[model samples]
Target: MRIPFALAALTLLLGACTVSTGAEPEPTQVAGAVCDVPDDLRPARPYRIPQDEVAADVAVAFNMLAVSWSPQACRSGKDYPDARYQCAANQFGLTLHGLWPNGADNKHPRYCAAPGPAIAVETVRRHFCMIPSPSLQQHEWAAHGTCGWDSPEAYFAQAAKMWDGLNKPDLEAIPTQRLTAGAIRDAFVAANPGFPRDGVFIATTDGWFREARLCYSRDYRPMRCPRGLGAPDRERLKLAPKGVQQDAQRGVQTTG
Candidate 1:
């Protein structure tokens, strides 16, 4: 028997609306990364316990891969002693900020153990390309690393693995007028085919793009980001352009 005309139309509409459930995108190496680390690079300062910081060994609900836009960090002149190294030649872009284990409702675990020994100077030098700051690397190990991994080496290895896996977009290519939080997220998803759109979060300061936080499950698969994490989609974003120095005295914004 022939199907009813209305039913046939409905079936066609449903077929057209069906969503594809394809395999997830494989992670690729980031392009245009400029490490250019110096041979003599050393920790700007010795590691010390973060004053007024306390340990919160709460249950980890998920993981976040925080990546920084190096130009923005350098332009702000905030990371100070760390800036001496990271901003020296300004060759970094989309550097690994840290891999943090976040708990539910923002009660993330940190500084899980007392300061043992400073991370070996050689170890700090090895990962300088990825982190750029020796003191920050040591701090990350003592604070976030202690809560998850047993040794600094293991923690950094895991972080490096994840950092190398991401296919980061080249921010300098995008026109400044079209650069927005949503545009950055779109670029990320486009670069990583099976990556979820909501998995990327943008962090900004004074309307400048600072960081991109990618949400991940315990197994390290990309997942939807929690609400209220970073800047909204429509917010206009500015980039501090690699090699172009910002006039902090005048608070002028520069584009690549």
Candidate 2:
């Protein structure tokens, strides 16, 4: 007999529900579900998805495709089968405004209601956190396309971990002063040795630093970067409060 599709889907959602396993943090607990995940969003389990691979998820479960711009506001792609989207749809290609997507000129009658946009927001949010297109389609499609987890708890836990990992990297309190790019990189590789070699991490770093430069007019990427990836770029590597790189580099060794 075929296993129920829901059971199969559930299997995909869980890391190893059937296997004998040690108790672990729920996705909500580990991911910081409560604050980051809205009430209407799904909760996540403390699943260990890779960092670089998290952002590309389409998160269309909000059924945004079910809604489109006015016919005039949309354009066809160069060819068929790839499909067309709203004139403002950033998915078509590199957009002038980046992914700061423009609003659709119209909304579907079904989605004009409150839950509609909420769902859409949730769908889009997954893309922000690195939920790539395929994973979103496979795991999030039937769930109404929200970019969040199964429960608020899971969402919050995941959020918490992400926030801590990104926003504050003392390298397990090893102190940032003595942390050279090489040392920090070593520490980072030690902690996450299994991470795949991919450009997404670089992309995410670029995104983070770009945002930092835009927001603070200063290099704030290290504040949120993991130690390994935190090695300062030659041009902007200095994390010194006094804007003195060599001095700060020396201080780390003195303290440690």
Candidate 3:
């Protein structure tokens, strides 16, 4: 989910059977399998960030967590159906963007060290989508992953822990209408107690939901989002109709 801009926008679904009870229903499966696929490296309990000596910003994000995904990926036409970048948006509603390190500032440290073996493509697909592409994966490792752990597996394993903790929102729960950024944040707050209103950051291109970020303290606890980070809480946003995000550029309106 790391990008070059102030914040990067990153790009979900469900089980063996598919279901959509509303106009903007979220997916519950992926590739005809249960969306909640398990990974081999998942820890028996939540991985806690160590309270050892570290920089102040790194310490600030110890225990916090957030969820992010691209509604664009679910829409068709933007990416070829068979392209390596295509997403199973219709199957597993919201794709898992990477679990990132939250910082007190807009920018954070990256490429802290040399990366180890590249995470196998198969391993990545087992848990989430592949829109980052292989090259982006390497970049994410150097920029964000390396700041925390040594190997790609260890960094991603910890990321998996954060991804598993949050509950995906039911986009269908909202009426088929434009939503304010504040409204979207409220929905997440309703589902996730202890996740502060300020902790949730919405990244969008105009109105489309690009990524939903959450800030945390070094101990893995939720904290308020940094000032001037994320989309405005009151900004009105739109949900691209299914398969239409390919041409959604015209509709994109915000910097995020």
Candidate 4:
């Protein structure tokens, strides 16, 4: 699930480039104008990216990330020369389930029947942002099941583009979530050659980890959450809350 972004966007993330969110933008004054406008502000417009559009863009992203099947793998080249092609089966997996707000319980397995490491780009995205989760939303609509599209997150996110569009907005608009440093590492580890934990993935659409902020053991105990926000770290001042992350066990169920 190593989905590559546009080269320029990739560079921006890798370089950890700072866009002007923190500091005040310089002011611009027009002739005979007493009021000054900030140069950094984008045009203000209320946007509710339609579900169809969100699914479509998401689909484009998924296709960009999906593995290509060669003629051999497609099985149409059985009559052709001995040629190796991409493996269509087990290429990648994803699932956008109903938001498991209550949290995953003890019965939650370390490995999900879905979202294999092969295609976990969306998984990584989940760890970072919570809202505008088209995949999760679509999964909740679960009256229909699409094959080769069982991975709920993959299909829903893409389908969202068709049903609606995904937009980037702040605070009152886009649902954003933050990751504990641990959660970020956990995702990287999940994609590692042989991650020991199965179903060990933590799913949260909003908020940062309480235990993580409190310095819990690397062992990620969803059941052992410390109460309330504790001592502040350097970045604590910069933290935003989509709402606090509940105990790990809370993810066991999703609210329909």
**Top-TM-score candidate index:** 1
Write model 3 residue lDDT over 1-256, tens digit each, in one string. 5455533322131222222334543333432223322222121111222233223344323323434344454453221121123233223345444556655555454445555565665544443432222333444554567677777677666766666566667654666564777777887888788778888878776567656777676756777766644778768877654333343322121111
TM-score of each: 0.78, 0.23, 0.63, 0.20
Clashes of each: 0, 41, 35, 41
Candidate 2: list runs displaced more than 4 Å: 1-27, 31-35, 39-119, 125-172, 194-256
Q: List CA RMSD, all candidates.
A: 13.3, 21.0, 12.7, 22.0
lDDT of 1 by residue, 142-235 (tens): 7688878888888998888887677778888789999999989888888788888899988888999988889999879999987654778888
Instruction: Rank candidates, lDDT, best first.
Output: 1, 3, 4, 2
Candidate 2 lDDT at 117 equals 17
lDDT of 1: 0.71
Q: Ranking under TM-score, best-scoring first? A: 1, 3, 2, 4
- Evaluated against the true structure, the overall lDDT of model 4 is 0.24
- Give, for candidate 3, the lowest lDDT window spanning 10 residues: 39-48
| Residues 32-121, model 4: lDDT tens digits | 111112223221111222333122111110111111111221232211111110111111112112222111222211112223222243
